[model samples]
Target: MLEGHQLLGFGFFVIGLWHLFNHTKLHALGSKSYTSTLWFPTTISRYMELHFIMASCTIFIAMELFIAPIHHQPFDPDGTIPTTHLHNFEHSSMAMSFLVYAIFAIVLDMKCTMAQHELTHFLGAIAFTQQFLLIHLHSRDHVGPEGQYHLLLQLLITVSLATTLMGIGFPKSFLVCFVRSVSIVFQGVWLMIMGFLLWTPGFQPKGCFMHLEETEEYVVKCSDDEALHRAVSLVNILFSFLVIGVTVFAMSFYLVMLRRYGGKVEYVSLVKEEHYREEDGFVKPKGTIDLENNMDDDESQKKSMQE
Candidate 1:
């Protein structure tokens, strides 16, 4: 289970990084030309991102529903859901929602209708919403130190959900894309951290330890109420530091890309010329000026000299 959380975290981190780089590059090149996309196309394949999402979600669903179960099944002899597997079912449902989103995204992209992008964004929003709901209403513990981590994770998911919904209406807004990507990165990082902190004895809080249950899952247990409080406080502190660190890193990355691509002579000159033209309330037509004709006119006599 720890490995699974880490794997999912790494996948999210990679996707988030990919989006962060692409979106920043687009904005740095020129905001006017920067249109938000739900996913980036890969050089190897246009559907690579969607394919990745579909594949990962399928694997996760299989893990939660089949491979990880005690008897290779989620249901008991009476066809009743075992209490131990409730969380697994909830997680699989979350993955299934993402799988649906990915399938619909590919279909919408292929259709190439006027509202395709908007519909894709709406689908993405729905997937995030499903993820938020599942995690928010998880059947597992939600009051312990581990729960604190999940609570913070839900906050990040909310940001992702909100930004995805906003993308439908503001598909041209780079800020929305930027925030959404960062939130995903945060979620990935936090999940990995939670997995390590809660599962690894070395990383657990001073007075906290992992307790194995009949469900074959390890839970975080603190020695006393004070220890539990201290552990939760530490999690909050870690979250604050994570926010600061990620923000600085994101802004620094943006500046670097801006300096490398945003300063191109053509882009700068075009933007400057457009600004001046708009200010002067006039636009010069594209063509060569008739200098010879102007030089032969009466208005040129005052500026011309005969040798």
Candidate 2:
């Protein structure tokens, strides 16, 4: 029986694998036998690969924080003091929020591939709206009863951009790009803050080496507390890099998809047929198999051979 952290890590592993494994077969679905093994690749169908790529980080964080530490099991979530810090919740929830979007995006892509453009696009907007509001709410609360700080101002600026996005009717992909950009910058800013605080020479007290007097209920820090700190620091650094990587990947892939979509391709009408209209005298163009002029020559040659 695995512990809570192990369970959570296992769940992440499952999700991370699900999309990536399913991504490749989408192209061959429509051409061959219709089975559960097939998936058709349109813009929407192909995006599962990207979704999985982003969500993989969520699993990484889960394992780093919840599962094995650089030592073994670092017990620190309970030790993180200053509960008044709203940034704690904001940062912790970021991965989970990304997970939500990945799931919703998968469903939206499914709809879009089915040619349900309106509903699919609508769902995409709603997911964006959810994230925008979350950032706005968390940012608003971060200032604590007043809005006069620089971080507060930055939060408002981001909100304003989101508002502008809604007002001007930007395309869904563009909106996604905007969000991804802002989030990456914000993550870097947060990482810098964390590093500054950690290395401040005063963040952790020397006298309170084991946090002994804080609470009687508090258990002593594990003997490997130094190792725990190193684990935490390593994970923090890796997370920053992951965020940067994701931002670049998102931007590049979005541009690539835009390019591919902008190119002209063969047109196949997907509209429903009107069987109700009586076809009094309409002859559709003959297919290539029927258009050959060689049949007449073949018959003439046969007659000559008979003579």
Candidate 3:
């Protein structure tokens, strides 16, 4: 399970980073012509992002449902579901939602309908909603420092969900897309942190220790109430630091990309052309003839003719 969290975290981080770069580049290159997309096209394949989502979700679902269970299945020998595997089923269901989203996004993109983008955004919103609900109502108990981590995680998921919905309506809003991407990246980072802090004995809180349960899961237990309070407070402090770090990273990335692409002469020239047309009632051509010089030459010729 620890490995799974880490793997999923890495996957989310990659995808989020990919989106962060693409969206920033898109806006930087041409904010006026910007339109939001649920997924970005790649040089290798137009559907690379969607295909990745589908493939990852499929493999994750398989791992949660089939491979991770003690009996190699989630069900008991008597054909009933085992309580120990309930969380696995819940996780598989979340993956299935994303799989559905990816499949439909591809279909809509290929069809090229007028509402394709909106539909794609809607599907993405649905996927986020499913993820939020699953994590909020997780089958396992989330308490102590772990609970604090998950509680903070839910806030990030909510930001993702809200922004995805906003994307459907304000597809041109770079702010909405930026926030959504950042939230996803933060979620991945937090998940990896949780896996390390909760599962790794070395990283456990100062007063907390890992306790192995009958279900083969390690739980964090504090030495006393004071220690539990301290652990929870430490988790909050970590969350604040993460937020600051991610914000700085995001802004720095945007500034770099904006410098590289946003100030291009092509986009600047377009703006200049529009300004000239608006002020002069026509676009001023490059290297235009000088009317003042022409007038002066004509006057000289007239004076010479008079002489």
Candidate 4:
């Protein structure tokens, strides 16, 4: 199977082509909020929903990656020792993350579950990391001498994973942004370290497959191999840009929006209170009672008038 990067190149090509021919329609999907619509009922909230999906998908896919073949892929592409421990750790932690979400969901009653909130961050990191990994794979750096079939498959996985993470619904909030940013850092650092390890002098494939060499690298790298690689590169880039770039980019703007709307609401409330105070200079407090004072005042006034 294609490891990861090759799939990204393929996906990028398709997305770019889609926009070249159908940018107008795609733009509309983002331009307006549809209250009656499931996703667009409130555009921001809808995006939050999307972020949740991406996060959940990220965890699920990561889990799936670990489940088969070896029943779990080593985090390392280079068959490095670190990959095993890291992958296992992340694998075990996933169950904990699941528990956290389950508890959060049970305790709170909100439109979104805790998993969705956490996912926002988890996915954000993947957004950048995946993009970097994918591009690097297609570049001179990550590509390898493998079967074309495997190359394309890897390319597909990378793209699909990136596409899934950089999806239409990433949230504009810090929750998602922070997670994504971190993911970005981790993805890059991890890949770079592994890429270095791949070339390390001591590194040797312990498996049965490393000694074999194909007629030509079966891995169809878009950079040197096929139209498919170049074709998908653009969209994958866009996805990277959209997912990581947008999440990071839109943060300040979201803060500004929060301040703007919050100020308006506060201002309106203040104005209404001022209006009421001006209209009724000495308004009685809510639930205020003066049983003794009121009764004594009434009797005193009555006695004086009679006298």
How many residue pairs collide in each prediction?
A: 0, 2, 0, 29
Alpha-carbon runs more than 4 Å astray in model 4: 2-65, 71-126, 133-141, 144-307
TM-score of 3: 0.84
What lDDT score belongs to each candidate, Candidate 1 first?
0.87, 0.40, 0.86, 0.38
Tens digit of per-residue lDDT, candidate 1, span 151-245: 99999999999998898888899999999999999888988888788877778988988888887777889899999999999999999999999
Model 2, residue pairs in steric clash: 26-39, 26-41
lDDT comparing candidate 2 with the true structure? 0.40
TM-score for candidate 2, please give it.
Answer: 0.33
Every candidate's CA RMSD? 8.1, 16.2, 7.7, 17.6
Q: List the residue pairs that clash in candidate 1.
A: none
Best by lDDT: 1
Q: Could you tell which candidate, 2 or 4, scores higher by TM-score? A: 2
Alpha carbon lDDT at 33, candidate 3:
96
Model 4: per-residue Cα lDDT over 202-254, one tens digit each: 33223212222242222223333344454345334434554565346435534
lDDT of 3 by residue, 51-149 (tens): 998888888888888888877788988988887888888888878888999999888877888998788888888888898888889988989998888
